[model samples]
Target: MSAPTGKALEEVRAKAQADVRALRKRVDHLDNDAIDLILRQARSHYAWTDKPVTDEIIHELYEITAGGPTSMNTCPARFVFVRSQEGKERLAKSLKPANVPKVMGAPVSVIIAHDLNFWTELPFLFPHEDRRPHFEGKAEHAEVTAFRNGTLQGGYFMIAARALGLDVGPISGFSNEIADAEFFAGTSLKSNFLCNIGYADETALFQKLPRFAFDQVCSFA
Candidate 1:
């Protein structure tokens, strides 16, 4: 009910600093350049070996990702891991030609989805007050809010995965309609993106790409 106390704040600060220190070693250095490289290299990977991704590892990633903020703490994002032959086949059929092969070849692909009826469950997630009534008559607003927040959560998932020494290949070139029907059938969750998770082959990457300077993208005024 109340804001964080002084001790709570100190504890949070200590934990965050400790996390940064640990991540520094895991990420090769806790610098902006290292972060940029992590983001840049976490692109769509096409070639994969026959290694398997364990559910325990995925659960670990999920636990880390649960810390990402969402609007009203609604946390509307949902993920469906497609590991079975039938599930992968269904997911593969929905990818674009350029993405299909990579998705099919990856050890595991996760479908990041947003639930249309997520607000209805907010009573449990946002327990301070019943926020479901606020969204009851605002279908359009709810959809946009859920999509935007869930997308943010998905980005955090990728960053957390990278921090955990896993390579990510997130793609949007999949058929929403088909994927929804095939993989998300009987569910209110709608496909937002697909990401292949595994180790990266350093030899498989092409030349590095250029990026805009900070001045070009940001302004002090």
Candidate 2:
């Protein structure tokens, strides 16, 4: 990778700025090399190399992902890092047989969960007023919204990991009820998804899948 010249940097920035303007939005102008690498190939990675993912990278991923928006700033998303062999073992028991080997071999496994009672903390997280009152009588509503948005945050977590030079293999082919029992016992948090993180094995990549074009999947109306 060559260093970007000042003129080249300015040209890319100006083009991005114009694109955002045409799209009627203002995006953060952070110049991140990992972001460039991630945008080049954002697909899910299956096989992984022996290279390990560091704790520092995971911390940075969370720091960046938390900047994404959440409803009422509720930020109900919670992440459980499964790094040790034992920790991975516990989660592996809940995995479908097909996923067991993939997850166990990864450098890190993440349990992305949503707190069913996250609104309880709204008084502090959204402290302008007693925002808890707004969520009090709407228990079911809170759960639904939290699950939806928390799932979105999990997606952001994957992208952030990819943006920080890690590849992700996110999976939902597990027993959620069993996962909750094993990992989050006695907690209001419910497991939404699990993802494996590590350096990708390029040789293991499948042929790139096709995607629908804009007109095939969207409407101007």
Candidate 3:
């Protein structure tokens, strides 16, 4: 199928918004299948099948991910979809032994990174007011906000991928220094974590692990 042109893209987006509104009119919450697709039944996959993650799906994933709200809409997250053999090799050099195979075997390995200079785009992202002054000269504050919000976007990214039928394997057991040097050289982007994205080899999966119950993890403030 042909990729949509500029106008076609706008039409597609409009149709999507309309569809959401129609669905909302029917029901306030998603069906169980959607809950399963987005979160409930999704698992962190370490082994992958041969199917490749196409560029179109990656683009759609980001479109959904970017829609998620952030503080002042800072939108600091930057993703590098490491797919080529050479790219995976470069990334593998930064990985621990166990994570190396996971990256190499997956069709796409994502470097979920953040831009320290993200505030420069506040004029475009948060144009309601001049928010740039709050972050411009404050290096420490900017870095903290970038990291916090960028991590939030990264979580949205993974959930979006899951919603789009891709398994995600998020891991932090890697060398940030090497990744920043290899993939983000001379850039403000700093590595947060890595994720293996692809169709999973379900046979290789371990039994589902237990999660903490609400009583164990939450309390009224």
Candidate 3 local lDDT, 1-221, one digit each (tens): 24456888799889999999998899998889999887888888889899978989999999999999999999999999999999999999999998888888899999999999999988788755778889978999999999999999999998999989899999899999999999999999999999888999988888889999999989998
Q: List the candidates ranked by TM-score, beginning with the highest.
A: 3, 1, 2
Where does model 2 exceed 4 Å of error? Answer: 1-36
Q: Residue-pair clashes per candidate, as listed?
A: 0, 0, 0
Give the winner by TM-score: 3
Give the CA lDDT, 0 to 100, for residue 175 in model 3. 98
When summed lDDT is taken over every stretch of 10 residues in candidate 1, the lowest stretch is 37-46
The stretch of ten residues in a row with the least summed lDDT in candidate 3 is 1-10
Q: Tens-digit lDDT track for model 1 on 27-53?
A: 764677567656854464667767778
Error of 2 at 98 (Å): 1.0
Better of 1 and 3 by TM-score: 3
Structural similarity to truth (TM-score) of each candidate? 0.82, 0.82, 0.88
Each prediction's Cα lDDT score?
Answer: 0.83, 0.85, 0.91
